[model samples]
Target: MSQTLDMFATDDYPALTAGVDEVGRGPLCGDVVAAAVILDPNRPIMGLNDSKKLTEKRRERLFDEIQQNALAFCIARASVAEIDELNILHASMLAMSRAVDGLQRAGESVKPEFVLVDGNRLPKWHYPSEAVVKGDSKVPAIAAASILAKVCRDREMCELDKKYPGYGLAGHKGYPTKVHLEALKTLGVTDIHRRSYGPVKALL
Candidate 1:
């Protein structure tokens, strides 16, 4: 195991340290989703890595494993309206805060003493947290959070595909791909499209 992963497995960290991660920040449509996960030390999940590095099948499988094995987990999001109102960075922070807050509210497990968040920036919240540049890859808890957040958001995008159609949301998950851009140009923007985004703003 790598140094970081090894540290997590050892007793060097807090007993109740939650891992935080977010997804869909780059998507031009759909909400930015975030997840907070407190993994059980006794229930070690193998193959935990950055969600992007894993296949969809792997992520989906891990998503279930994390939810079933973790002491507590919560998924949260900032909607398109919130994203436009707060801007992506602040909106992403809001989503992350919500995820952590939701876990705290669940009251199913002991409160987290520390938080480990992916990315260099921490949300404007009261939680004692440190951001690791690639925490999702280095920390198993963060990796599990990444998987849950990604799977939840991807499923949402697939549902949006059924509702919106022609946008290829299921395929691209609202990223500004060639197909998405073409659909935007032809079909114009939907209510779900983030108007503050460059492509959507241009169309507007």
Candidate 2:
């Protein structure tokens, strides 16, 4: 119910289609995640906020609602290797681009006229894009996308936890938390970790 969120809800625009948001760019292990969401303006969800601001349970609930209600949606990722090769920023953009491409591939006839991305840096893509600072908190569509990306990346990290038992991936979700740093000190880097990252590279 913030003023910024309210503004996006009321903004008049043609073909206000999918919004884009990304996650995991800063993680030392795991892929860069992105999501594209197209909200139904007629049926806006209540209590929409940035994924980081919501509880896990709330985000899960919103994720389900978004998948069910949105006209089209897609989640995508750029692998840690890809992130290393392209650098995190470009890799994040590539992930977003892949999400947008997936939406098109799924037969969503209407292309987004404008893509509202959830950060100050805009991705280089064919479609027109606007980078909105704090967009996930301000725009419902971006919020939905953020939830999807976070959930998706969290799931991936959990899977990695099973593969690398001592890494605490599930607990930290591969971020550079104190616990994660401790784990890195003990276990060193895994194949899934971005060796190019400063903390991870310092281990080398």
RMSD each, Å: 2.0, 1.9
- List the lowest-lDDT window of 10 residues for candidate 1: 1-10
CA lDDT scores, all candidates in order: 0.89, 0.84
lDDT of 1 by residue, 1-204 (tens): 235555444256787889999999898999999999998878888888899988999989999998888988899999999999999999999999888888843456446778899999999888788898888888888988999999999999999999999999999999999999999999999999999999999999
Error of 1 at 134 (Å): 0.8
TM-score of each: 0.94, 0.92
Q: Which regions of candidate 2 fall more than 4 Å away from where they truly are?
A: 1-4, 104-110
Residue clash pairs of candidate 2:
none
Best of the candidates, TM-score: 1
Residue-level lDDT of model 2, residues 90-156, one tens digit each, is: 9999999888777742465447777888888877778877888888988888888999999988988
Candidate 1 ranges beyond 4 A from true positions: 1-4, 7-10, 104-110
